[model samples]
Target: MGKYTQDAQQLLRLIGGKENIAAVSHCVTRMRFVLNDPSKADVEAIEAMKVVKGSFTQAGQFQVIIGNAVADFYNDFVKVAGVEGVSKDAVKQAAKKNQNVLQKVIAALAEIFAPLIPAIMAAFVLVYLERFFRKISPQVISSVVVPFCSLVLAVMAAHFIVGPIGWKIGSAISSVVYAGITGSFKVVFGAIFGFVYAPLVITGLHHMSNAIDLQLIADYGGTMLWPMIALSNIAQGSAVMGMIILQKKNVAAQEVNVPAGISCYLGVTEPAIFGVNLKYGFPFICGMIGSAISAVVCVMTSTTANAVGVGGIPGILSIQPKYMGSFAICMVIAFVIPMTLTFIVGKKKLSMADRVGAGDSADTVDVSAEAGSISATENTETTELNGDGANTLRAFLTGKVIPLKEVNDGVFSEGVMGDGLAILPENDTLYAPCDGEVTVLMDESRHACGLTLENGMEILLHIGIDTVEMQGDGFEYLVSLNQKVKQGTPLVRFDREKIRTAGHPDVTVCIVTEEGNAKDFEFVTDIHAEAGKTEIVLFN
Candidate 1:
C-alpha cells in the first residue's frame, strides 16, 4: 500500500482492471490470474514491464512474473484490487471447499513430526535416564557454569544449525522463479532487463515488473528471475567500478564511482546509472555486455527460484538449489566482464563529465553517511585496572546498546557468556568497535564476526537472531580474518531484509566474550546507540 500503490494501480489497469479477472493468485515469482477475457488485457503493455520475464495464457490462466518480492507485491495487490489470493491448486479444486487454517496447520505438523514419532516413542523406555542423571548430579551450578554453558551453545548453534537450514530452504526454493522473461526466453529477456531496466526504473515503469514476477511464481513454481536480477545488478555495480577504475587520480570520477559501486552491490543502481554510467558513455555499454552475458548463462542453465527479492548478492536465497552453481558462475561473469572491459577500454582517458553542461549533470544524493555510522570512540584508550596479575587493561567498545534478551537468542539473553550489548541496527553495515585484528570470521554464514583487540579484549558481533539458519545468504564480509582494522572500519554489509524475511530478528549482538571475571564488565543496555560512536561496554 505504501511504496507499491501506484505500481499496483498501473498494473491492474494494464491487465484490463479487476473486472477482467475471474480470480487472482500468486506464486514465488509471479502473479497468476484466471481471466474471463484474456484479449481485453494489453499484451503489449504487459510485456513492456521490466520485471516481467514473459506472459502467457494457459488453461484460461494469465500469468505475470514478479520474482522474489512477489509476496510483498501480492500483499499490496490484494489491498488495492480487493482480489483475494487463491492457491496454485486452487484452480484445479475450485469446486471443492478451501482448506482452513487450522486443518492446514495440523496437516503440516503431522508431516514434520511423523518420522520423529518412532524415536519419540522409543525415548519413553529411557525415561529412567532422567532419574538416573538427577540422582547422580551435584546440585547448584555456579553463575559461571550457566554462563559458560550458554556461550558454548550459542556458538555451536550458530556454527552447526544454520547451514543445513539454508540448503534445505534453497532446495525448497528450487520451485520458485523470477518474474521476467522466463525459461528459454530469459536469455532474450535477461539482456533486455539488464540493458533496459536502468532506463525503465528512472521512468518509474519497472514497478510493473514486480507484479509480473508475483504471478510467474504463482503459475510456474518459482522463476529463474533471480539470476536475471543478479545479472542486471552486478552489471550496474561492475560497470560503475569499470568506469572509475582508470579515473582514480580524478577526484570527481572517484567520488562518483566508489559510492555508486557500493550502492550497486546493495541492489540500488540509480547512482551508478544516472550519476555516472549513462552520463558518460562506455560504462553503460559495458554494463549491457555484463547483463547479456549473465542473462545467457541463466537461460542456458534454466535457473529458477522461489522468489527474487530486490536484486544483488542478497537475492541468492531466492535462487533454487539446482541452479545455484550456474547462478554463481553468472555472478562472476557479470561482475568481472564489465569491470575488466570498461577499465581496459577507458584506460587513462579523461572523464566524460567535461563534455556535459553542469545543469544537465545529475546531482548525487549523499548516502554514505547512512552507511558509514562507525567512528573511533573517545573511550577506546585502555585504562589500567587494579592489576595484581592481569596483563589486559580495561577498554571501552562502542556501538548501539541493546539487550541480549531482546536479541531473541537464548545464549545471549541468559547472559550465559560475558555480556556487552546489542544494536538494533539502522543500516546493514557493521563496523569495528576498536583497533583490532579480525580473529574469527564465521565463513559459512557471515552473521557473526569476532575481533581480538591489542589490549586483550575479544569481542563478538553477532548479526540477527537465529540468522545462522539462513547460512550465508544475503551476507557479505568486507574484511577477512587476520586482517587489521581500525575503529569504525566497515567489516561487513548485509541485507537486513533478507534476515527479516527469513523469520529472524535483525538485532545485532555485540559481545565481550567472558574470559576472566564477569563482575569486571559493565554493559550499556536498552538504548538506541550509534554504531562506532557510542560506547556499548567498558570493562573495569
Candidate 2:
C-alpha cells in the first residue's frame, strides 16, 4: 500500500519546497520538521487536511500528527519530495570541542553500551520469566520450557557480551599476524592455546575445583595449570597493551589511546575491533605470539575441557579455580611481551606533513577555542530587537487559542525540534520580541505570560513544558507588570544549560497564532532560527 496520499503531498507542498525543511525525523506518532522559517509554513492548510490529525510547532520543530502510518508517510515524502539528509556540518560543529581522554573513553563506552540495550532488556525479561515460572512450579525447573528459557537468556547474554570482546581480540591480532610466524594458521592455533592455558590450568585447579578435592591429580601433577594460565594472561594482556602503545605512537587521531587502554584494561576489546584494525595496517602478530605460547603449553599440559569462554572478564570468571594460577601467569606474560616488541619495532609519531591528508590545511587545526566567541556572535545575530513597532494587523488577525498541549510558564514540554530530548532554558530572562505593552500577564508567572502589541494585537508567550514546580528559580523576569518595552528590549534572559541539566530542553521561542477564524495573517521569520535575531517572527 502507498505510504502517503495525494492529499498529504498537497498539504506538505503548501508548506514550502523541501529546501524549507531544516530537518525531518519521526517519532512513534508524529512526523517532526524543523523549518527554515516558521512563518512560511502553511499551518491552516495542514490543519485542514483530513490526513493531518493536528499540527503545532514547539522547540522550533513543526510536528504533524499522522498516527500509526507516520513511517510510511515519511518514507514516501522523503523519496518523492527529495528532502536532503540532516546537516553533517552540524555534527562536525558539535565535535570540535575538546574533551579529555577519560571523557572520550567514557563516551565511547557509552556508545558501545547503547546498542546492546535492547538485547539486555530481552535477556532480563527472559530471566524474569524463568524466575516467575520456577516460583509457580518448582517441579517444572528441569522441564523443556524452563531450560529452554534459561538457555535463551544465557545465550543472548553471552552473544551480546562476548561478541564485542572477540571482535576486539580479532582487531588486536593485526600487528603480529603478518610477522612471518610460519605454520598452518599459526595465529589461530596460538590464540586457542593461550585460551586453553588460562581456564584449564589456572582456573581449573585454583578457583573452579577448589570446592572439590582431587587428591590423585594433586599428588601426580605439579601445579600444572599455573604456568599455562600465567602465559595466557600475559599474552592477552600484552596483545592489548601492545595495541595501546601502537595507538599512542602511530594512530593519527587524538584521544583514542585512553579508550583503547581502558577497553584493554576492562578486557572488553571493543576498542580493538571498531577502532585500530579498521584504519591501520594489519598487526595480528601480537595475538598469535601471545595465544600461541598459551595454546602450546595447554596442549603439552593435556588440558582437556574448559568451563568458560576465553574472550572477556566475565567469561574468565567461569573458568575452574585450579587453572586460575596458570591464567594469571599467562596474562602477566602476555601484557609484557607484545608491548615490548611493539615499542621496539613501530613508529612512535607521524610528522605534521604526513598527518595532514588531502591538503586539509595542518595550520587550520580545529577552531574550538573560539567557541565562546562564536556563541556570543550567535546570540547577537539571533537577538531580534528592531526599533520598529509591532505588526498590529497580523497580530489582530492571529486569533488566540488554547494550546493543544498544556503549557505552564515555569514548566515546559519536550518541544518538536530534533528529538526535543534537550531541556528548556529556565533561569535566564526572556526578552520581549517587539515594542509591546504587557496586556495579559498571568497571575502565576509560572503558568503563562502574555503581551499585547501597541497596535492592539494580542500575542502570548509561555515559558516551559512542565516546570511550574521550579517556580522560576533559574529564571528571572527583567520587565515588570504593564511595562512598556521598546523593540529588542531584554524582558527575560534564561539560563539554558541549567534547565537542560535539570532534565528539560532549553528551547524557548515565539509562538504565533494557529486558529483559522482570524484569516489574512502571516508569520515573518523562519522556523529553525538562530539563537537571537531581529524580527524573530513577523505578523502581517
The top-ranked prediction according to lDDT is 1
lDDT, candidate 2, 1-540, per-residue tens: 365757657756877867676677776456667666667888867754545645655334566766556688878777766774344334222332333465455444433333333344555666776786666666845476676767776677657864455444433432232221224554454456454433332112223322111211233233223233334444444554555544331222323434444444444342332233222322235544555665554434333224323343333453456656555554544566656654444333322111211101011111111111211111232244434543521111111222323323321122211001111232354555556665433333232344556444444454444434445556545555566765555555455565666675444434432221233454442232222243334445
lDDT per residue as tens, model 1, 131-180:
44445555675444544554455445434654345334433433333423
RMSD of each: 28.6, 25.0
How well does model 2 score by local distance difference test? Answer: 0.43
Q: Cα lDDT for residue 426, model 1?
A: 78
Model 2: ten consecutive residues of lowest lDDT: 357-366
Q: How far off is model 2, as Cα RMSD?
A: 25.0
